[model samples]
Target chain A: DDEVITHAHGAGGGQMTELVDAVAVSQFADAAADVGLAALDDGSVQPIDDDHSVVVTTDSHVVTPLFFRGGDIGRLAVSGTVNDLAMMGATEPLALTSSLIIEAGTPQTTVERVTESMREACEEAGATVTTGDTKVMGSGEMDTLAINTTGVAVVPKGGHVPDAGLSVGDRLIVSGTVGDHGISLLSEREGFDFGGDLESDVQPVNDLVRAAMDAGEVTAMKDPTRGGLATVLNEMASKADVGIDVEERSVPVSGPVSSAGEVLGIEPFDVACEGVVVMGVASEDAADVLDALRDNPKGEDAAIVGEVVDDHTGQVVLDTGFGRRYLSPPEGEQLPRIC
Target chain B: DDEVITHAHGAGGGQMTELVDAVAVSQFADAAADVGLAALDDGSVQPIDDDHSVVVTTDSHVVTPLFFRGGDIGRLAVSGTVNDLAMMGATEPLALTSSLIIEAGTPQTTVERVTESMREACEEAGATVTTGDTKVMGSGEMDTLAINTTGVAVVPKGGHVPDAGLSVGDRLIVSGTVGDHGISLLSEREGFDFGGDLESDVQPVNDLVRAAMDAGEVTAMKDPTRGGLATVLNEMASKADVGIDVEERSVPVSGPVSSAGEVLGIEPFDVACEGVVVMGVASEDAADVLDALRDNPKGEDAAIVGEVVDDHTGQVVLDTGFGRRYLSPPEGEQLPRIC
Candidate 1:
């Protein structure tokens, strides 16, 4: 048929751009589209409606095994999707669907488990898995379970969404502890013995998001999936074109997760969070949002981690407990294995 | 960690069902969600407002070599999504997300092409790829290009769904020539030399569907995907529990596709169709709908090949050109292969 995908297309950056523009767009050109190929194509098209701004983001999870330490492909699939919807101000995601690429030899069990996870997640999110499809490949063409899910959630009538929500003196809040999901997965991958209990922090945060929203006019929300808390906040700051000042000591991190992080020589800030949420809100609403978040079962560990200031331009600076500052966007490309 | 997925999981249907019902659900379970999980852990608890209903559907495209003769994984991904949405009475698909299981050694170019294809498709359908995820499997865990896509299409207000309006005198109408997509794919799959200008019927049917909707009071609409033409009509008949009679000669078939089918020992009716649609309507509106369909680019080959009768319960009797009658539904299982 046409050319198949090259490995670098999965790299999450520049080369990915070329592949989309050259082959993907050319082969699937749509005559009815205002721009034959839209933003994801050669030319960018502005959002149709300006008043109701749309939130956009993309993420990929390449955990070594399709199944994981505490969960399998299905759970991971749903968690990744619900987390994306929550990051935006949308509520009650109405629908979601997933496409599957199965290895020729993949067990039927894996496919069902993943769909089951999606169904369960949809039911939880008040959405439906109204449409779906399955396809198989020759052996070695795909991982046993690789799923891609995209969906939508309705923004409430009074909801306001914009990247510039952050400003001087605004507050930064975290729904709960971070790095647990990443740590748990890493431990399982590295075969670290957990004395008592360790689990991935993967969970949907709609409840916590809704709670946080009720607590205050949230400036922005994000699920730190790939580059973790630091990167997410950095992206938000860059897009909002604001500076972020944070107290690393105040950012909640579980003892086990922190210990695991130290041993692995990886910062918890870049660790993946299955359910954790990073929130930006008005300084006045910080305490209230934390309270509301803690009240929710999923956000019992929620806390006010830091504040947003106008000092540094789009950079996130961490104030260590000893009154020292550490620059933390990530020194280089985080290895793919950790997430 | 936990085993992602292995060969045992993809076994027979019974095992597949159990796997779907168990682990996958638990993984995506939300806090309030019942056992099943999405991100929140507790279910996504939101009540409905009572005015609208959401339409849900899922599709998976696993083409050979992750690309094809006239298209590639990217084109198939988008077309697959759009077509599934049209199968329902939805007007424009609102969003699309894909879950990918990419093999580690696969080139990144391939992944980008597929994602770009997804992005383009969303634009054409007036939908957004608001969220998506990618997971890479260890080397040898999968074939290079398996992709699963799930989408949501908002069904317009008014009971625009198939209510089995199927009456004693309703006519069965097919939107266009069949077996093109199937035969083309089959030819490519096997090393058979096929001739003629045969293109896969993988175009989206939003325009064609709109034409049909505007044409008349429709009884039903079904897209022949996995099961193909014969099984689709049979399903409509079985659901209505009414007898469906199809005029064999009147059913349209592309000459080359038919020729290829004969040579390959494939039943044209059972082969997959990427763009064709099967519609049932009141006998009176049949002509108008057929006319409207023929006017669209996708429906130039539309045909009215059958009608509903009072007997046969759930059986579909096909009128062979030579006066022989054949019962078709398929013996035990569908193609088990979704690619």
Candidate 2:
């Protein structure tokens, strides 16, 4: 029998092996896609094979109480990396690598829990921490725990990457519920005490994105994180030099996350939306994109949340469920550290 | 014009941009390789071009008192990542990813210093922190901070990756003086009263590694991190199923570091080595490897430290200048956190 992960889990000994074998080995055994779920070194070490096809993006997580409600550092790590890869229009994230800066005096139990959670998250997303390094710091240097998860997703062939493909009047579709991840984090982070069976929507969205990609409907895709749907919209608009208009009612949000947002004086639209994706689809493919997104379990609540419009070029405006409309971007960086 | 890294600097933000621009921009401007020195994103999307090759390794850092000496969290993040890549025989590392777990109420200033230091480290190593996430925990939940830095290095064409390439009768060479990094970190980490110019040799070893690679030296290279030169030699022997005999007289140790180690009950041979590389070379190419390593600033102290003999398979024994011999890979892990 293998030893369980303990304070000595990070001690580079037998227990660490047990922790990795049990939690990591099993979870990523046969991931859903071709991402580097298994069979690689410390991260993705495969040599570079493509040319002129690349995308880059970055995000940070400052989940409060370090962890809470339903997830911890590891889950957050996988989802965080997967979302970044998706944002790049990378088809399948082949591998992930993590760096941990742990505060001194943290119980080994917490570290093991986080590692196990990361394994689960990676398995769900079809990626793994192939390579990594660790360092320990003294007390009073950081919050309880902060995980830096970075992922490398291979851009799908035949699908247009973000840099080269875009046009005006594209349809904007988002899979599933919005604001849940953020609302949950806010609720747990600040002790807002939102009632009902609500937890962070911090699950990996790679498969859902894959489904959408497979449907042959999207021009570009992104996951709404730290800056929320509004900021992501603006970024796409700026990058593609297009405009966006959204019917707020068409976007889905769970009741608890919504209620929690209102109580915290935060806008549900600005809350983080993990396990969800926003895609720029050709006008002709709009219907297919929505259908594909809604087909998945996590995307069951999908909808045509907005459309790419030339009038609001470089702008993201949301039409209220009522009649009034509100400008979204230019408000700048909503919910810092939401990631 | 604003400085590149901003709120994202603290948040892993716009300030992160300024930092990268001022430093890493010129080095890793490529889309796939550089994710922005922000350490906000994961390593870039690298397409797999070949099969049947993978290299894996882990490193740790335990800068005492939790932080300080010369470098901080951020600096260590890059140095650690780049160094790992170097040991893997890769000249160019795509990106460096990291994680952070900080204690409650850690000073913002200290965090900034470390982050800034990391920026410098990333730039120097020609590596970037493409992706990362952070967290904050409750009071009494963590110490200062701990970091884990993971790297992925491309295995050069037709060259044997580290773990698989060694053979019997190979000569052992070290890039520079041992124990400097260990003692420097010890002095700074503990704030010992006896302070006499102990500089941390925490520089990126990628360039030095490149020098060796160019020299076309024979098989296997590694950074002597947590367990020091002694441990890695033992590990190599064990993994390759060979025997290694290192001559203590040939292994260089700075006078001060040797003296410090004697006073602290530390074995200089077992102390961590930063900015140093230990490589196994075929007897035919030993001189080339040594010359290449010595030509570089970081490896100027390079020397022929020992040889891999056939008999003592899976073991490493050091013959000190005196008649006494000490077993390498001492019974237990030495310096638990000396990344």
Candidate 3:
């Protein structure tokens, strides 16, 4: 572990995982003792009954400029937690708890606006904020607002996906456009007027995940939040001891978003996506999974972006039109506090 | 509602309640729509099986100094969430999730120390941190560190203490010394050293709460956190529509802790407590409950400090040696970020 934590350590990039593994995860002595935390999926699932298990996931949102073009921290808090559970193969989202730490002097209208957005997002995800706590700090003691959301989802026994379930020859799919959220928020935070139709793609993806699960067997699943698509695939490859190969042409990226990244000097794969899921499925069922994802609004642009391979075990490779290049995880906080 | 948020709104005092009701709770359109959030206890509980229910509580700890004499944020985060579940009558703490929002440049040693404390506290409470998330903000974007923990616990069917379960003939009990946590943190933050032994009473109280439940029927239960004892009693009275009469002499306060509160110009009742529980038990079972509590080390100083009465409905009356005086809930911000 580094002597001091850097901004990159929290950037959901390669350093972020290293910090977590070294500082946070290392301290938990029993995390790997059959408590279901060893998988390190977006969420953790524990058995609550013989026939069902409860999925629990939490995320603290310190996103700057609480409000963006498409969503606010309120919506991000709920959607992120819901998506975490969905990544764990939770089919039915149940109850959620919200905790807010607001900086003094924040406008009351902003709180209302954000909370309304939260309720709308919860409604969309088929969940409710059953309990919540709120605290306000001195003006300079905090940012505008920080929200933490914890969600509980109930799924049938033994029906959830594991992060380490990827196998050689498994197909990898990108739910939709990548890097929309990161690019949109970075533009807003830095006062960059792309002056185009760029908005965050932050939303609940439980429906899309449900559709994918119903279509075929999903061996592994993840939501590309802080680390973007590249980091998540790298995590899957590292955790499952497999290799990933992606066609540069097949990875879906909107023209405007790609252009924004190019102008910002940030790679599209190194940013974040608040409303996307990357999945690993059996190669034989890839076509069916893509068809099912395409049928949903959230996954209308879903594509089979890559596949698991055995050649470069525990590494990711990108295939260009003429050559191949290794895809390495971003080093440090490429985009700080984007989520 | 005030146009701007204030520090009092997060102080766990009367103003905090008002803000929560006006902003956060009001925006939750369906919290009371049969989702099990309407009870408004320490935590919201939902049934997981016909024979059991799961209790979930989330809290954000933003204490000024990350480390204190008796405990640090890590212990506070784990204990606080565990205590919330215990107050809800959850006897068996199951799993917990920790989310950390760290400022860039925080020392890795500090991170390791805090997480180690968290693990120790979890082990004491018989719970595990099964899952977690970490986010790092820019150096100036956040305070030193903020930790949020959400805990899940399972309780047998019909074995919880409801906030609205108080009756006219019930006796109120204080588990142990109050104001230790609030006063200790305040003195440290303000650079006051009485030169005597003073430390925060921050520890896991699942055992104390479990013992109280085993002793007798706990009509109502709550931990005197941000709002203190008087505030918690007032909440119980308001929610249950009963009167509470507290005996000033019977309330247990340590010599140094009480003296510290007196010097700081803060009421013993307006501050916070990290490891105490207030219970309303039936009058006939009060003796047995006290005996059972006294049998445990954590509850050795337990006392019947008050009682549920018929007069002064929805209010609290403090009985001094000379006369009786009305005890009102604190108005605002007794000690900012004193979690």
Choose the strongest candidate by TM-score.
3
Local distance difference test values of all predictions, in order: 0.62, 0.60, 0.84
Give one digit per residue, the lDDT tens place, for model 2 in A1-339.
Answer: 322112322221233234334323332223222223232112222224443222222233446555766676578877877766765556466555555555555665565567777777866776655544344444554554555665654343433335213477678887878788777876666766755467778888878777777776578766776556775676677667777788888888878877777788777776667677788888888888778877888889888877777776677778886674655532432343455
Residues B1-339, candidate 1: write the lDDT tens digits.
Answer: 233333223321233334444544343433221111232110112222333334445555666646666566666766776665565566576545454656666666667666675666556666654334454455665556555555444343343455244778888889988877777777776766676466677767777888897888677777776557876777677767898888888899988888888988877888678788888888889999999999987799999999899988777888887775755744433343434
Instruction: Kindly report the interface RMSD of candidate 2, rounded to 1 decimal.
Output: 15.8
* Deviation (Å) of B113 in candidate 2: 6.0
Local error of candidate 3 at residue A158 (angstroms): 0.8
Query: lDDT by residue for model 2 over B199-239, one digit each (tens)?
Result: 66777888888888788665877677666777678767876
Error of 3 at A316 (Å): 1.6
Give the worst 10-residue stretch by lDDT in candidate 3 chain A: A29-38
Best by DockQ: 3
Q: What is the C-alpha lDDT profile of model 3 across A1-339, one tens digit per residue? A: 458888877777666667778755676655422226656778887777677677888899988778888889988998998999899998567678888988899988788788889889988998888788887778877788889999887678788888778999899999999999999888878788787568899999999999998898899998988878888888999999999999989999998888889988888887889999999999888999999999998899899988999889888999987899988877755877787
Model 1: DockQ score: 0.28
Classify candidate 1 by CAPRI docking class.
acceptable
lDDT of 1: 0.62
Q: Give per-residue CA lDDT, model 3, range B99-217, as digits (tens).
A: 99888788988888899999899889888888888888777777878999998876776766777789998999999998999898888888998784788899898898878778788
Q: What's every prediction's RMSD, in angstroms?
A: 6.1, 12.9, 1.8
